[model samples]
Target: MIYNEISKVIDNKEIAENIFEAHLSSDNLSKIAKPGQFINILPSSSFDKTMRRPMSLSYQDSNSFKIIYKPIGDGTRIMRSWKEGDSADIIGPLGNAWEVSKNKEAILLGGGVGIAPILNLYNNIESTHPSHLFFGARKKEEHFIDHNPDKNIYISTDDGSAGIKGNLFEAMKSIFDINDFKDKSIYVCGPPMMMEAVRKFSVEHDIECHLALETIMACGIGICQGCTVEKCSDESSTDTYRNKYELVCMDGPIYKANEVKTCLL
Candidate 1:
């Protein structure tokens, strides 16, 4: 892991009680980064946390990238209290980014905190591919208002505080059924249940889909072998997924929609 320092910290806001954003600059990393990739973040050595937390590269310009995160534990809590001059270690633009191929249209699905990577993926594909974004959140407050773009963005909240009356999957089905979209590609990132639902919908409609998996990762690289998923096969012919234990950090945080199994979740 190539260690880097946090150059700039700007715009601190509490979207929710624990949910916050830390925008940092690492120009070298951002120059080579693509969509669907993430950066592992580590607070100071004096801090209590030893493990690095992975956060998606939220936005980038010519010089740097940013991360949207939540202060969930002691580590993030310490990081959130840091000032502009403080230092943090980062290791990315790592793993495979979302592939925006020649497909004319694609559907982007996001749930809860899962929206981070999906938002970046959407920005990369939106202009070229006609796309629809369907997001599910706990309530209207958790909808991640920062990432929702103006074009074709749809939302659903469990408490009926947002766009639709029910879950994200149901809202997705309703949008597709009403609009008569066909033969499009799909990209999904969310809870495992939501990913499973997306897989089912894609199968039913014969839509090609990709998924950004949100499984736990210990090493953000191929070493730990902690995060794995079963590959798609009727007969278990291939040994690609959790069967062999692929690392989420190195191999993928984003995988082919049909490539990984969701049965465990």
Candidate 2:
């Protein structure tokens, strides 16, 4: 269900350098919220910006939901300055959720701010399932996680300052052999380049892979005709169109790696 409500900010703090986490108290929004779903936050204070900024639900409970983000632009910068007890207009629990089968082993992959949603997925599946997180960052300080009780984490840095010397894809390839994962499921969220690499790797190995995609969205819903991703045509009628397009806001932020034309690189 989509909600447009005035939600009170319970807590807002910087967990890492330039990365902030905000906890908003909204019983209605949090109730139906799921991992991979997101909220469109309207910066009430910044009336100059007309569009809402879309943020993924990082953590959620019965009474509240959390979002982790970096203030990259004006919209998010305004959001960063917002203090606790401030009420903001928000529309969510938008987008699709991840679906996992109990029979297969799952691997959770995320890079940078993309790890926000992956964290939620890990929390839900870690208890009963065999899962691990391969997190990537540009440097050691950028690897912002305070603690991990599960200890099922693998870190990768672009520079050699952290866990693995290379990127997440390389770390993933080295840690787990592609040949060994025949029936495993991979849940990944990252930059498009990283996701493309993961998608290709999954395809080459014949592994079932799902991706949480990110794109520029003016509206969180499908009204704006924005955030379209190219997808391979599913129809049998072969007229001339080789590919179709889908809205990231409406059709997904979550899609099977095979279903979209994301990994051409």
Candidate 3:
């Protein structure tokens, strides 16, 4: 279920160089929010922008939720200037969420802003099962987000500024035995190129991989038909099956890696 509410910004500040973290207080919205779900926020500024921006749920407690974003454009720049008392109408908790089965180990792979959802996923699986995180960014400057280093979290920077001098998958290969991945459930959410690399690795290794895809959305309710992705029958299935377009908003922002054609688009 989705809740539309005018929620107050409890706190707002820059957590990193260009990234701003905003905490919102809402009674009804926070209760139903789950890991991997996102919220559509109505911009109070940016009059020219007609549609709400979809921001992933970065952190959530019992009474409030939070989102971490970069003010890269007109809408987000305006959002950055918003004060704590300001209110915005947000619709959430939207999209399908991530899940883990009993006794199954989890491997989280995130790149760039795709790291947003993993925080929630980690919190859920932390005490229940063993979980590991692999994060990647373009540079060390972009690695401003916080995570427990003690909790088996590894990082890779493109410039070798921080941990491994490669991508998240490369970081993974350097740390753990690739053969052990077959028994683990991998969750990935990142850019297209990065996700493609992860998808290829997962397929080749015959691992259980789930991916969170990001795309431009308008309605965010599947009515806009804006975020369509090609659906594949299985990892080994060929083009002989007729291509089908699935709406990311409704069908998923989260999907099994083998169930979709990640390399095509």
C-alpha TM-scores of all predictions: 0.86, 0.93, 0.91
RMSD of each: 3.0, 2.3, 2.8
Residue 97 deviation, candidate 1, in Å? Answer: 0.8
Clashes of each: 2, 0, 0
The residue-level lDDT of candidate 2 at 30 comes to 84
lDDT of 2 by residue, 9-102 (tens): 9988888778889988886988888899888988675557778898888898988888889999987787798898988888989999988868
What alpha-carbon RMSD in Å does predicted model 1 have with respect to the real structure?
A: 3.0
lDDT of 1 by residue, 138-236 (tens): 787776663344668888887888787677778777777723645567787777777788787676666677878767666766766666666555565
Off by over 4 Å in 3: 145-150, 234-243, 263-265
- lDDT by residue (69-98, candidate 3, tens digit) is 888787788779889889888999999998
Q: What's the distance in Å from true for residue 256, model 3?
A: 0.4
Ranking by lDDT: 2, 3, 1
**Stretches > 4 Å off in candidate 2:** 146-150, 238-243, 263-265
lDDT pick, better of 1 and 2: 2
Best by TM-score: 2
